[model samples]
Target: MLCIKKPSVASSFEELIPKILTEGDLVETEFGERTKEIRNTIIEITNPKLKKVPEKYPLGEKAVEEYRKNLLYGSKNIFSYDYHERLFEYPYNEERINQIDYIIEKLNQQKNSRRAIAITWNPKIDIEVSKDERGSVPCLQFIEFLVRDNNLHMTVVFRSNDALLAYVANALGLISLGEYIAEKTNTQLKSYVHHSVSMHVYIDRDRDYIKKYFPEYLKYIE
Candidate 1:
């Protein structure tokens, strides 16, 4: 597993992009040809709130803000799944579980709770559908919250991640969620850890963009 430890999300993302370009193995997927891939990559951010968008990041500040809002509170759209719906109103056996509430309550009751976990994957539905038929499947699977030394730490697991295009946005969104949880539980926010089972960049889609904006890393690609 490749581990990247940084003080903020921007730094981690900046480092991650080049690392994947240089160290990742070429792989083919149902989507298309990916330039590079690394499995079980971990990113640890010591301070989630210190997130500043890197100048090289493709998206603008407004776009990133919109994504964070959508991840935290957007309504369900045409897609098969939405992260906000799965987290705030998780579907169970004929019932919806407010996982965010549960996590807050658990932490308030027991600061040392080890069971404050929220899961996005519903096996009954997710396991039965194919991506072609479903339109979208949940890439983020599990989220766990821990409190130690009066600080709350969050860890998230993703089955797959588009490291180049989606990772920075994902990290920022989850950091907002963690901030919400920390406020609700009256704990200070600390580290944010993200784990991706398969972290990759789609070469055919992003090659020109990377070449134009991140020429410094061209040595790795050529």
Candidate 2:
């Protein structure tokens, strides 16, 4: 019997994780069977105890503020990728780097308590890895994060997706990224996602495969 229950706002994502662990059955997502495994891991790390749920799961406004404070004061653990480069890319152009510096300086100049954010999500410019490519895999990537009251919230971006086949992977990726950023920045990460409309074209075609392994996946949004 499936005993899964939805989480309440009073509890954080961490608190909900255990319900997923003990009461929740692994529901298939577009991504694949791996979703269950990853979800299980997230719960294990967030809430070690299933006894009493925490008041805040850390995905709150204040949590996001803490994270930004850390980024401004400590290391910025930003991760990026370049499909064309076939590896992680660094130093977003000199101009971009300069902008970051400028923002930092401006924040101090104005004596402001907020942070500046720059994202990489232009499909036209960002390189995509393709399957037919003789040398690399075909994929799309981008980043998204939240900022409230000038405090940087959690950010999550992704590379590659099977809108129907691997939707779970995408969700897990975003959620995990939010958790990590929240932990590092000491803030809560609000969630958002961007996807290709063309993905539907492919997903519709693979309806059979999706239904066979991921029957519960479609129930996600429905």
Top model by TM-score, which number?
Answer: 1
* lDDT tens digits, residue span 87-164, model 1: 998888889888999999999999999999999998777776654653578999999999999999999999999987
lDDT of 2 by residue, 44-118 (tens): 122211223233322334444443343334334432332212212223454233333433344434433344333
Candidate 2 root-mean-square deviation in Å:
12.1
lDDT of each: 0.87, 0.35
User: Over 4 Å off in model 2, which ranges?
Assistant: 1-132, 135-138, 149-160, 201-207, 213-222
* TM-score per candidate: 0.94, 0.36
Off by over 4 Å in 1: 131-134
Backbone clashes per model, in order?
0, 22
Q: How many backbone clashes can be found in candidate 2?
A: 22
